[model samples]
Target: MFTRIGRFVVRRPWLVVVAWLIAAVALTALSPKLESTTDQTEFLPSHYESVQVSDLEKRAFPGQEDQPAAIAVFQRADGGAFTDADKADIQKVATGLQAKHYAHLTKIQADPAAVSPDGKIGLAQIYADNKDLSDTTVTENVKQLRVDVKELLSGTSLKIGTTGPAASALDAQESGDNTDAMIMMATLLLIVVLLGIIFRSPLIALMPVVLITLVYLTANGLIATAAKVFGLDADPSSSTMLIVVLFGVGTDYLLFLLFRYREFLRAGMEPRPAMAEAVARVGETIASAAGAVVVAFLALTLSTMGMLRSMGPSLAISVAVSAIAGVTLVPAVFALLGRGAFWPSKAWKREPKNALAQRIGAMTARRPGLVAIVSGGLLVALALGALGFKADFDMGGSQPKNLESVQAMDDLQKGFSAGKAQPTQVFLENTGGGKLAQDQLAAFRDKIAGVAGVAQVSPAQPSADGTVAQYSVSLAYNPMEDKALDLVDGALRDQAHAAAPDGTRALVGGTTAVLADIRTAVERDYSVVFPVAGLAIMIILGLLLRSVVAPWFLMISVGLGFAGTLGATVWLFQGVKGANGVLFSLPVLVYLFVVAIGTDYNILMVARLREEIRDGNDPREAIKHAVARSAPTMGAAAVILAGTFGVLMLADNSMLQQMGFAVAFGILLTAFVMALFLVPATTTLLGRRAWWPGLKEQAPNPAGEEPVLVGSGRTSG
Candidate 1:
């Protein structure tokens, strides 16, 4: 089947190229504007008490003032107090910024106490009317406001900087943008250098770049169309993530095929036939791997958070596209490049000794049990990190201390109750027919204020309709703290609701409430999304491998990988690092990337195993041959991917660093242990049974060519 595809593509290279071109051009043109949300609240469902209260607040108090989007904090350069003239200048600065009419900022406030304790720093509250912080326009506006504010602060004695929810969000966005650029550039350069080194051909090095570019454009276009048709809400992080997956995973898949093609050619086959045979042999693995990744990402649909929900579809779309490109565009390009793809280095004509890979394969073949036990133990040790996982919902703490937003938050936390800086609002709604009296409201406030975690309760005010009363409750801790969430949902909210007068009900809304809702949303999503993604991935695996048994274990291996990765991240960030909490969004992010991409390696190795099995080798011999042949490519690909993600750890944000480590570590484990060691070893132990209902039952190579299988000795069984 792969041979037929190879022949068709080679025979009609121009047709193949043109087809891909048409798809790429059309998709790129039709692609919708990708969007993302930095506002953690926006990711939560509207049904949570927090979301409900927020809605009530908006409806009750139209254009209600809350936290400022960006607080332009100003201070004297030499650490001096603000003069009356300095205050006047600060006012002028605020006025000047407002006059600019930056779309992101609806209002700006310059107050004296907006200053720091040393009398050095002052602040301007830049307000946006947005209830949803994750909106693309809002974040972009915040970024633009930062720039505008910077210009306004020039020439003033005050060394002014901005910090607030909006500013922190903007910083994260910019950091991700910068990080993506560096990672992509680094990955591309590495690929170019590595491919050039391996194949000794610049043309070969450029092949993936050229091919993946087309695949990405086309895939993005298709995703836009799918999103438009299905009404999928695209997240901002999707675009950057898609870029990495396509280039990173796409390059790996291409390399897998090319290496095999080169091998066949060295055995004296013509370029067209060799390419076709190579694709035939390896296509199943690429497709299966892609399927697994797609499934894992799709599992995110089961996530409760809108961010993860949105991210699942976005990443799934990307991996699916890469898979198609791996099978189609890569082979077509190789067909066109022919022997010239490996030009400048006649190395393609002769096989290297490959002493290192051969030695590893020989060892595994000699002692599959020792290999399995040792590799599994390493993953297990790392898996211990899972025990210490903590979830941090604090946006301010996520960034570096040097960031103006982080410093400002720190300052705010010192002066006021961390809760006062961001308070939880509880709305007592008249769910019944009539309004309640002031006494009832006062009684409710007293009860809420008395709750265990409550630090202070502001006086309650009646809603515009006079049917609802809003009370602001400050906590002793930051709003994102677990204790805060517990206060709102457990003791505080329960007491508030319990104390509500007849004909009235209570709803809690704030950052903590939002996070609680997001957590619920994620749980619901897990049940729905994980199974669907798993089933879809299995179907893909089934079709590619023509075996039911393989996909089941593949899912299990990938599933274990997810758990181990999460466990490790928790240990590192929360246990050892003593972080207040891991990023609340880490689990979802890990599920989407680690599981999906991990499946990519699984498919690669498994497909190669199947190929060897069909080539007249025993199960043990087939496992050894498959590992020997596929490990180098799979390992190379994993290293590149891990290295690219590892760059994310350099980010000043704890969230990004955790995400980087988890993903990089997961990829390494998948490639080295699961794909190279466990998968092959397990399949070998399963023997002909592994491919039951498939063709492995047929005699190994009916033609009886005495193939030189790589291993024959050790089996766990």
Candidate 2:
């Protein structure tokens, strides 16, 4: 199948190249912009308490629902306590801003009663005309409100800055946009520099950059089109992640073909046939590696979390597109470039000495059991840190501390209750669908207020129908902290549910409740999604290797790498750095990338090992040569891919920094430890049994794939 594809592409390279160009351009022009939401409730299932509260509020209250779109925090110019006159200035500013009746500005609430105890901070809550923060009108209103507030405060003794849902959303979106640009530029530079260092040819370095850029455009357009057609909403971080996946994975596939293509060239074959033959030989390997990634990602569709469910299919689409291009478009481009792909460097004509790889090969060959034990043991020791891993669900903490919202919120906390910014709300719906008296509302509020973590509970405001009541319950701690998680998920929920009046059932819903639910959902995903992904990946490895035992051990190695990576991160963040916790989703991301995407390195290495064994070398000899040959490819690819993600560490956001470190460190472990050391050593120890039922070690070598000489650049043939 691959041979036919190679020949066809080689015969009409121009046709292949032009088709890809058209696809990228046409899709880019026609597709609507891909959009995402940051609203936590939007991602929850209807059954979750938070989602239910939202639904009930929207349905029962209709036009009455109004939350702050932005909070205008006012203070004296020198940061002194606000005098009575200054409070009047704050009220005047709010009243004047309200009179302008800006678009999407619902109402500006400012009160002397809302002043902080320290008297240094004053607050004004700006309601929006819309609900969804994704709506640009909300963001625009935030911008306009800031301008209006500035104008209203002109020449006054006080200064005001806006912070809240709309303003924070605007700032976060801008940060993401800038970070995405930085990630792209950094990834491109990283790939080019690494590829140049590895191949010693500027063309080889620049070729994958240009080719993958085109493929990225095509895939991105397809993802947007598919998402729009299907009505799917993806996670906000999907675009930045897709950038790394396409370039890192795409370049790895290209390198696989380039290495083999150059081998055939050194063996004295014509450039076109050599390119075709190279495609024929390694195409299955590339397909299987990509297939593993695609399946693991697709497994995310099983996730109950909407973020994972939507993100899964989008990433899978990207991987599928990259794999297709790897087999077709990449070969065609090289077919045109031919021997000149490595121009200005005659290294392609002879074997280059890779001393480090050779030494690793010799060490594994001399002591397979030792290498396997030591490498496996190191990973296991590192994996112990997983026991201390803590999950943080705070969106505010993940932002740069310097962000206006974060800074303003911190200032507010100094003079008010930490959780005052967004308090937990509990709703009581009359199950009998009857009116609720003031007594029942008071009794329910008292019950919630009795909870240990409950600092304050506002009076219950009954709906017009009188069948529901809303109470704002502020906690003694920050809404995003672990104390908040336990309090909301445990004590508050328990109290509310247990103490409801006979005709009323209570539902706890707020930022903290939503956070606790997200934690529960992710925990459930661990049991469901992780197992499903593992099983799916094992099936792919089993089918690709035609070996039952190999898949099990290979998966074991990858799993260890996942744990090791997490443990290392936990040690760094939680232990040494004294962080409250790593980002909540770090484990999920690590498992998906390290256990799934990292499998690519293992697949490449093991396939090479199997090839050496099929070429009639002893298992130990095969392990030696395979490590020597595959190490350079996997190492180069790993460094480049890891660097691409590591670029995220440069981001100001802690979420991006944690994600970047996890993936980058995991990739290094996957390549250097599992693929380079453990897998080959263990395979040598297992010998022919690794192939088991297929047991093709002594089988005849296929005609097109002659046993290439391992020691030298040229083939034995």
lDDT of each residue in 626-661, candidate 1, tens digit only: 777777788788887787677667667677788889
TM-score of each: 0.88, 0.96
lDDT score of residue 147 within candidate 1: 75
Q: Which portions of model 2 show Cα errors greater than 4 Å?
A: 697-717
Error of 2 at 383 (Å): 0.7
* Minimal lDDT window, size 10, model 2: 708-717
RMSD of each: 4.7, 2.4
Model 1's alpha-carbon lDDT is: 0.74
lDDT of 1 at 87: 84
Writing each residue's lDDT as its tens digit, candidate 2 over 1-717 gives 787888888899999999999999998899889988877788878889988998988876778647657778888999898887898898899899889887777889897788887889899988876878557878877777777777788878998777777888888888889999999999999999989988889998899999998988999899999889999887888989999899988988988888888777787777888878778778988999999899889988887788888899889998889899998999999889877878788877877787899999999988989999999999999999999999988877888888877888887787778888788989999989899888888888888899997888999878889899889988989998999989998989999999997877899988898988988988888898888889989998999888999999999999999999999999998898788999887888899999888999999998888778777888888877888888878888889889989999988888899999999999999999999999988888888889887757445435776432233453521
Model 2 TM-score on a 0 to 1 scale = 0.96
Error of 2 at 217 (Å): 1.8
